[model samples]
Target: MPRPSEARPSGARPSAQVRRFTPAERWVHRATAALMGVCLVTAGCLYLPPLAELVGRRRLVVTVHEWAGLALPVPVLLGLASRAFRADLRVLNRFGPHDGVWLRSALRRRGPRPAGKFNAGQKLWAAWLTGAVLVMLGTGLLMWFTRLAPLLWRTGATFVHDWLALALGVVLAGHIGKALGDPEARRGMRTGFVGRWWADSAHPLWRPGD
Candidate 1:
């Protein structure tokens, strides 16, 4: 076999990059994020007295928040038209032996653990956020159309919605922090491609098929 230096011409760059996301997947993610941001901002303005006073548009804020929350699931539903997205959903859903190992290693602060395209933490976050968004939507609808439900139901929905919105905000901040710290991950989500070296080091078990 040829030596490392002889494997390619001098100054040649590595070309083993891979596509990390599809165009449809990227679009869906962006759309969902946009809608979620709108919902969060509006919710804050509606709930916080100082923010509400500064914004000074109660009716408009409420309208925007309701509409944004209701439409948050649209992009994911539309993304189901793409085979790639559906395949990724399956990957995110299944927890294999490596997932357990990865989580254990993570908690123990051990050295890097083998992982696939999505790690155990990412999979859990995705599953949780999906459920949370759906619940928020349902509760929001109940609160919006108050006449559709009785007083007790509306009261419970309001309680859940308020607490869940706070939780979502905190979780979202952590997600953004992680994304900001990982340039390769940000690049992959933004441009749909990631360096082969990054994949090899961070997600050793990841394969193109996965």
Candidate 2:
């Protein structure tokens, strides 16, 4: 084993890192995220008075909304349970000394946007969003089943669920907004393989043997 002094240089080309996510993992993430997004958008629109009027079929909209909400977490939960997903979680959660520097520099348009496999912001986003989903799901279930908690608490849970949903929606919007602003990022998830430069620049803290 090599000592720290003998370790590979930071900028040196690394040995080939295998494509991490398998097709099933990709499918699960995409499907769940897509469904969750649709559920949020549709439900949010419907919640607004004007959108309720604009919707052609109220019952159909509600049905689809409910179904999508239920389905959205399946893949995410599955991913969380798998080792690959857990490993991904670790990489995303890893905060490096460079992350802060990159963040500060990026504020001035000099930050490492494509530094590693994931960056500090993206990791934090993933962690919080997933946690928010879990909370919302729990509250949603209590409301749906109508007997998990006290009647009063069940009502309160509804309020909590809606509030968290709204908060999560804001974060989700920001996440997607950032992705859309950079076509490379949008392509990463779409193609399930981001460019070499993107990984190098965006996620400098991420490397193999992590």
Name the best candidate (by lDDT). Answer: 1
Q: What is the C-alpha RMSD of each candidate to the true structure, in Å?
A: 5.5, 7.4
Question: What lDDT is reached at residue 103 by model 2?
Answer: 76
- Model 1 is weakest, by summed lDDT over 10 consecutive residues, at 2-11
Q: Report the alpha-carbon TM-score of model 2 versus the true structure.
A: 0.74
User: What is the C-alpha local distance difference test score of candidate 2?
Assistant: 0.68
**How many backbone clashes does every candidate have?**
0, 13
Model 1 misplacement above 4 A:
1-14
Q: Residue 125 CA error for candidate 1 (Å)?
A: 0.4
Q: Lowest-lDDT window of 10 residues in candidate 2? A: 1-10
Evaluated against the true structure, the overall lDDT of model 1 is 0.88
User: What local lDDT score does residue 44 receive in model 2, on the 0 to 100 scale?
Assistant: 71
lDDT of 2 by residue, 97-193 (tens): 7667667776886534543566667667778877887787778778778767899989888889888888878887887777666765555456555
